[model samples]
Target: MDMSHIPDLITPAIPVFVITIIAEALWVKRQRAEAGVTLKGHTWKDTLASISMGLGSVAVGVGWKVVAFAGYAGLYHLTPLRMGSGPWAWVLLFFLEDLCYYAFHRVHHESRLFWASHVVHHSSQHYNLSTAVRQTWTPMTGWVFWVPLALLGFSPEMIVTQQAVSLLYQYWIHTEAIHRLPRPVEWLFNTPSHHRAHHASNAVYLDTNYAGILIIWDRLFGTFTPEVERPVYGLTKNLSTYNPVRIAFHEFAAIARDVARPGPLGQRLGYVFRNPAWKPKTAQAPEAPPPVEAAHPSP
Candidate 1:
């Protein structure tokens, strides 16, 4: 199989994805029955929405890949380093590509514009295998983060192949099916527990664990948070609808509205580039102080 085409690596996995999702669905059913109550594990609407978003992501990636390949190839032609495709080169790229992904994933959470594209993955309230497939349709912009890899002598095809491997590694982490792996594996790699923390909307869990294949990046970057409490899955400001169209572009619409509000150019720019949680000073209200009794301790 030609590993140069990114979609080629993913298309063959489509059947595997479908079969695993079905297996997870059965597992979900068993979990509900064993608990003797309905739980927030999976629903037909949410699973369908996730699958739809996955398909949309694939379509967008296939179309946008040409643009990405051109940029990478252009830079690679000018690169001083000529990295070979030997096993050692692949090993070097495996780590470098994963590091690039860590940076990309972190930025996607930190920046509003990028978050608009990334929020689709986190929009689902359920934590299941299907949620892994719920990827962004606007992944074209994410290619910029890996430009350095190509310039450092890695071929565009090698980069794409390595990225596909990283993505496949992450797919299983989206499920609650596996509680935890062996301690060594859990510590060294991105496992379900680490990813669950990453997916959580819990106060302490938010904006943590941005690893792709290796958890060490998050640990080194101080973004690692353990699974201490049961995670509250989904976005902090959860969406009420399961419509795939809305799910894909709602944050983009929100960014437009926020930027169009009467504001200085700086504030408008901030709406696009600042953290997703950031707001203009004029839009933010002063926090009310705590009660007098709580603020001032009794002597």
Candidate 2:
């Protein structure tokens, strides 16, 4: 586990961040304003949370690689997946990593244990390029979605490199700056149109479009929904507070609150691992709209 590659792994993300900021300033401003989407209330808080999560992610990647290398020491000496001269292997790794990401992402939405970490990314009401930087602070416990690659004997370096590329590719999809691409590109890739639907708070769009680089997984898995209308972006129950600490820990706090109520051990455990919007029998359900069309439509 050479820690040297960790820095290299994250360096590519810097340019993606730079390009996204430029795109936002030059293009997304009008779209955001036209859609009545403003980060004015949560910008600073989201920034802090994003920075915190970014730091934590670096640590997790490094630690995870160490464990991975140790686990496979006698079994296999992992090599970096390179795409320098001929890039077919690189391309294959990219798609493979994305395939894994689709699974990882879908489970994060469907399962409660993974949702605890993933919810931080979706907690922000305003969707923009910056929102893409708002990432998860914790290494999702019991949710090692990349294990399949390891089982197939892919080295830690290869896995990390592939993941970095997949993540870099996804950064561009975070913007409202880019609209529909030519014909089949929109149909194949995870375009801004598709991702906006994924971010929508609208019930029909909720928990759909979990693809990373490719939308085909969602299409195949039946999580796909075309962005036919404007998306109302935010959590079902909007967190009005701008405190990053509050935004990051709000769900955990709610889980704690639910667990404290009088109940059997099984019920308390169920409260922690059940679907995110789930409530105890004694708890009141939060009023929210049923599924409807997304607020932002494709042109």
Candidate 3:
């Protein structure tokens, strides 16, 4: 993958991101103070951890994108259908890429291996702008999911550009400041409300709302759950530490431990590939030979 030729949409928005986060932080602080409530949404430590993880993700993404580009470019070159770079192509990909994201995001939640990398985003309990920047360090595992676009004839550059656009679109939805948008906009696009449900640890919200830029994918796929009650953010089993290294690799460590346990090949494979909640069945203890000891003592 040629980095020079690839059009990056994320780097240009870094300044905008910093400005928005600061503005939102100040606004949140004021709102809480005015309401006679302590500021609980944003914390210095949480914000730092989020930014740390975001930086880590960016560093890893620079090198990891080579793998993504290779996978995408390989498929595109292999397929005979070459999609044009026309406006229609971009419009078609805008929707198609979002749909691909919906599927990829859904699998990341349902499969333990993918969740190992994804859990970094959900490590923070605070629902604020910084939380959106909290990203995983190991995104290479998901590079293959978007290769279908390449197979369908989209160029690697187009695929990567659309992906960055999608990532940028998702950044603003991390805030609790925007309660809801217009009804039509809410129904069509992935908004703060829909995303709150996605970040929520509540049982009803556990795996719902996997839309990227469009909420229509979730609505169409039956994964759309509205934010009714206040969302309880963070993982079902929240990590106690604020360390970025732990936040990034804790689930991966858990996966390793689970797969290393003594079990059949199939069971071990399931440990890595199955749901995060899945556990290996323990072996029953063997009964002791009680009579043999008694007989020897009597003799």
Q: What does candidate 1's lDDT look like per residue over 1-299, in tens digits?
A: 23255434777898999999999888878988887644457789999999999998888877687788778888998989989999999999999999999999999999999999999999998998899999898886698999999999999889878888998888888888788899999898999999998998999999999999999998899999999988989998899998889999999999999888997999999999999999887789988987776467779
List candidate 1 segments past 4 Å from native: 1-7, 35-39, 289-299
What's the lDDT of the predicted structure labeled candidate 2? 0.70
Off by over 4 Å in 2: 5-7, 29-92, 281-299
Q: Evaluate model 3: give its TM-score.
A: 0.91
The backbone clash count of each candidate, in order, is 0, 10, 0
Candidate 3 per-residue lDDT, tens place, 99-121, comes to 99998999999999999999899
Which 10 successive residues of model 2 have the least lDDT summed?
Answer: 76-85
Report the number of the highest-lDDT candidate: 1
Better of 1 and 3 by lDDT: 1
lDDT for each candidate structure: 0.89, 0.70, 0.88
**The 10-residue segment with the lowest total lDDT in model 1:** 1-10
